[model samples]
Target: MTSAQVEKGSEHTSEEGYERGLGSRQVQMIAIGGAIGVGLFLNAGANIAKAGPSLILMYAVAGVIIFFIMRALGELLLYRPVSGSFAEYSREFLGPFFGYFTGWTYWLLWVVTGMAELTAAAIYIHYWFPDVPQWASALGFLVVLFVANLISVKLFGEIEFWFSMIKVTALIGMIVIGLGVLTFGFSAAGDTAAVSNLWAFDGFFPKGIGSSLMTLQGVMFAYLAVELVGVTAGESENPEKTLPKAINTLPWRIGLFYVGALTVILCVVKWTEFAPGVSPFVKAFAMIGIPAGAGIVNFVVLTAALSSCNSGMYSTGRMLRTLADSGEAPKAFNKLSVTKTPALAITVSVLFMGIGVVLNYIVPEKAFGYVVSVATAAGIWTWLMILISHVRYRRAVEAGRLPASSFPAPGGSKGSYVAIVFLLFVTGLIAYDSESRVCLYVMAGWAVALGIGWAVLKARNPQIAERREPEFEKV
Candidate 1:
């Protein structure tokens, strides 16, 4: 082989050494796709039930807090861009256990989320075929998403781009249609609902700030996947450029796409009238007298679920590679296929998704609710670690132990601690809310399970013991 070919061949495998295959558009759309998941498509109804019209403001507040969290993540990812970006940062900044815990924890998180997304796809399809077995739909999604992930990362990117575009178009369409109904009295549903619908009932904050506070749990869950951008940084073709561009625009994107869409819904429909039986987005369209509103929203939500499954596959594969590289997982996971993809990791992760089918067949009704609640809590835990890692990162930078990066987090270590506190507070609130209280218990149980697994792994692996020397030296 030619020298260049030899280099390329060697570069495609390993954890920290994979070729950068993701482009700017891929990174951007993946973020756009992953962040706007089935939550916004279906969970908006639940949020409205929590705080009424004030749900819109809750989304805005959650968006702002998550904005800072992403900023911290962006700065760290740029500083040490790698395949397991955040997990690697946790290890370097904190300790081996921190990295090991974060990586495995995140792996478990996405596995649960992937199953939930597959289940969601199945449930949506059931609207057309009420008699179709739920497992059939879940299994179908498992096969489709598995194939999409196993092929190539670029192909996944292409699919995610289009997937995200459809949802974005639907959301924008809803916003435009909603504004028309409020302004020019356009009636797609033969009802000219004015903006006054916002407060026509018990006023905007009908349930009071206490209820609004409770709804933030739903809002946080809605924003769970916003970090998909940072995870993509390692694989992005031009991390130095593309990562910054993607991260910089996060605030406005969330504002316009999430807060903006919710605002339009609140204005066009009273919170009292919001029902959990249908999507708020579809309800907005239906207000304009648009037939097949549910069908259109279902299609958009299906695409959203696909987008999430795509990212879930990508993240877990990379994280597995990181685990293998750190000697925290089997060395086989570090190997790549001839296609330069983490084939084994992808296959294992996708195969794990089959559990969704089993869960669906066992208890179809409660499966989604259980999976989403737990996934949301696990996701929040991952973000909390990212914040803590950033705090440590900033201190290293200030102590002159690390290079000053092109992208620096605003407000420094103190701000990072504030971000961490905010996330912990959110987690506590999720536990307090009756709807999401199960998440708190699941998170606690998962942590205990991980601790046990880690202890066993350490006892079995000699390499982990050897690796601990360097970790201790760093500490």
Candidate 2:
């Protein structure tokens, strides 16, 4: 296959209707913003408590796996940049059923993730307004973000750019302040703040290697939306340049935001001092005696939650539209509004995300935990599909059946295989942990449901069930 053939094959599909409103800056920020969300803001404290300083090692390992997965995705994106992303590759490489499953599962992933974010946002709001109902706060945020998404893709990009900017800026500030405490002993925690705090209490692996391994599930959850960058290919101003740059910077982002920030915080305030159900950054600030520091951190986390939920609305709409164009979902989702946005799809997805508000009402205490587990399960499936599809694409390229991706992943198919095994290991850990095991059960039910839906779609339109050859193969 020649470069001409690859370029021809990369032409827009059903995603052509989208406006290329997301610029390089917005895409870059989106990639950065997606990596820092409620998972790190509110959930890391629990992980730290469970793994001690070993949590840093777990994050580093998971970050490497995530980097491998993104490289695989980056190769495919450069091959065929589309809003459908992994779902499109899955259909071409795996089969139509796999594509359908990946599309709907990804859609399901963000919906539940939005629920978890809303739950977290409500919790953050409680720090400022303790008397307010969690459900009410969740509903308010849901409506605001829903409106922002309905307007236009450009608006969505701007909102996400600022949301992510706040998160990145606050995290950098936190790390700097943490360093100050450790270096000069300028704050209240200064005397106690030292690098030795990591191993001083109960050693680095305080709860044993088994307990530290259990935290991988949550760590992977924190990295869930990092692939959202792939979904923006159709809307990006320049997919080839912007997508690769976005993916290449992922390692450093993970290093600084997750590993570096956590190391600094744990150094200042011992892993044991951090508790579940609280933001470790907030706790570190409070311990350092920064006046109103906890309040400021709470506000930052609230934005983080909203940012993820906003992204959920954006990606779910696009995924639903992709499924609709492929005849796997309702046709109504195939239409775009005057602004060239998937208005109906966005509306339907937001309505489902409202289930989070109901969960907050009925199970406020458990809403965050329940939704996070389910989101992580769905996310694992999506990442596996990307890795598997990449492996298949590489095989096709090696066999002279398809042209190679311009941005080929390092180690070719080997990185994908490693990432796949790592994901499966995380899945096994999910099953081994009693609390997170419920997510696997939930995913089982979800699979059965998607299977039934596919059978009905197949019965209605046999063409939708047929596995088509890749466009390059047809040439």
Candidate 2 local distance difference test against the native: 0.93
- Give the whole-model CA lDDT for all candidates, comma-separated: 0.76, 0.93
In model 1, the Cα lDDT at residue 243 comes to 75
Candidate 2 colliding pairs? none
What number of backbone clashes does candidate 2 have, counting pairs of residues 3 or more apart or in separate chains?
0
Which regions of candidate 2 fall more than 4 Å away from where they truly are? 1-15, 473-475
In terms of lDDT, the poorest run of 10 residues in model 1 is 1-10
TM per model?
0.92, 0.97
For candidate 1, give the lDDT of residue 152: 79
Candidate 1 lDDT over 1-475, as tens digits, reads 1223223433433234565667778788777766688777777787788788888788887787787888888888666666677787777777777888889888888888888788778877876788999899888877887788778777878888899899888888888877777777666542636667677778888878888888776677788778877777656776777777887888877888888888887777667667763567766665555678767877888878877877788888978888888888889998877666778988888788778889999998888778888887878878888888888778877898776666887877666777778778877788677877987887788789878877877888745634232221343
Task: Itemize residue pairs with steric clashes in candidate 1.
Answer: 188-288, 188-289, 188-290, 189-288, 189-289
Cα lDDT tens digits, model 2, 267-293, are: 999888889999998888988999999
Task: State which candidate has the highest TM-score.
Answer: 2
